[model samples]
Target: MNLKLVVMVFAGALLVSGCSTSKEEMLPAGDHSMLELWNGAEGGGSTARQAAAARESLRRPLTGSERQVDAQGDRSYSRTQEREITQQFPRLPNPDMVMYLYPHLAGGNTPVPGYSTVFPFYSQTQYAMPGERTEAL
Candidate 1:
């Protein structure tokens, strides 16, 4: 009888230890479900109103000093200004070259017959490399 009681206690302890609740599991299965329930059904005008209110809270009128346009209404970029702007911005790196291959049509200037050719053109530089090498045709 004592052994049976000890085995039952051990089994109950194991069951209790194995069972646990995680934060992610404790959270509701679907996100925004509660929000939708509180707001209304899908496509309801409440969402639009909430979005408009959020946008309004985020918006503010521009002051005179913050205005970008000048009195002439022309975008001001003199040679010196343009040079300064260019100096501030850095150029992006060149992308990898892409190659294309096509079947050589018969009756061309070359003597080869039933041969294919490749043409590789670098997209960013718009220049062709000296050799033809590409995995794709």
Candidate 2:
């Protein structure tokens, strides 16, 4: 019975404390200058309108000095200069050889014609010593 009474008192105190109101500070209203600009309320058009106006705002023709300087700068570099960047290590050439095949019976009973097939004397890739012939036509 004593524990029950203590628990009830604690619960009641907690409920009372939880029900108390806390003081909250209210913030003052701020100036909305950016919002007004976005809405185009200052004689400028709306957001899109302001963007279009801004683009056209700098549409004045370039001055004669600016044109002359730009033309001189553009002529300094040539875009038509051809630069053929060859590989550091050229490919090694392989010698070609002719191979003749005599007419013979192939696959079981079929007689195949004598067709010639040419193949390179060296492999697809071949390495040579420091002082050796490795280039060809």
Candidate 3:
């Protein structure tokens, strides 16, 4: 008799533990739905229009106080300031040599001097494999 009672109690406990209640069933008494919080009736059609109107009413152009201007005017950079900027950031030696586009090879334009000159150390023969060697011809 005691064995049967223990088995029944275990089964009951398992059943209760496995049961789950949904969110709506678990909610506290007097809790409101999302529609109620938004001041709209449940399943209402006019809620979208009301929401858009509310958003539109919140929009307004910025006033003079909110507007921004360069208050320093042209007084920020004088001749002395310009000279200091140039001294700090010196101009490149050859700005034209820094070409962004590759010129056509057949266009008959010789590459600028120093561009075609290969470094002597790089041109020398170097062993690529255990016994194999290669050099720029």
Candidate 4:
């Protein structure tokens, strides 16, 4: 019984969808030009008169305050002026120390040259903060 009901509903849906595509609806009724619609010939019968009415509506003179706001509304002004802030003291360079390798055997009793490698003594970098005393001199 359930299978029969499902088959009947499926057949009804197919019949309804097949009836949507009629012969007349497949093509337009006449050769309607898009240019005529753009020039308002087919768009509501009359648009040139409507355009004149819209222009007349906006023909009023602007008030003094309104004119001032419109002239200054687009002109942008910065509240904060850009200026370089001079530091009180010069920036101190990070100190680097050289470590020398003593004359010793490198591999298989082979003597290696005493080469020195320079590295920073401190692991992390230190920066001076504002209003902080970094040096006495």
TM value for model 1: 0.21
Regions of candidate 3 where Cα sits further than 4 Å from its true position: 1-19, 27-46, 69-137
What is the TM-score of each predicted model, taking all chains together? 0.21, 0.25, 0.21, 0.29
Worst 10 residues of 2 by lDDT: 81-90
In model 2, state the lDDT of residue 112. 93
lDDT tens digits, residue span 1-137, model 3: 99999999999998997767666677754556776846765454667668799999999976665543333444455467667755555433321223344444444775533333223334334324433323335
lDDT of each: 0.59, 0.70, 0.57, 0.72
Query: Candidate 2: global Cα-lDDT?
Result: 0.70
Clashes of 2: 0
When summed lDDT is taken over every stretch of 10 residues in candidate 4, the lowest stretch is 78-87
Give candidate 2 regions above 4 Å deviation.
Answer: 1-86, 105-109, 126-137
Q: Which stretches of candidate 1 lie over 4 Å from their true place?
A: 1-19, 22-25, 30-39, 42-51, 68-137
Give the worst 10-residue stretch by lDDT in candidate 1. Answer: 126-135
Query: Model 4, residue 118: what's the lDDT?
Result: 89
How accurate locally is residue 69 in candidate 2, as Cα lDDT from 0 to 100?
Answer: 93
- Per residue, candidate 2 scores C-alpha lDDT tens digits across 27-122 of 434455767756765663357676888999979998999999999898766453332112333346666888999999988889998989889887
Predicted candidate 4 versus true structure: per-residue lDDT over 1-137, tens digit per residue: 99999999999999999988977788765555767655676654557767788899989899999999987875545232322122444344568998999888978799987889989877776655566666766
Give each prediction's root-mean-square deviation over alpha carbons.
19.9, 22.9, 21.5, 21.1
Whole-structure CA lDDT of model 4? 0.72
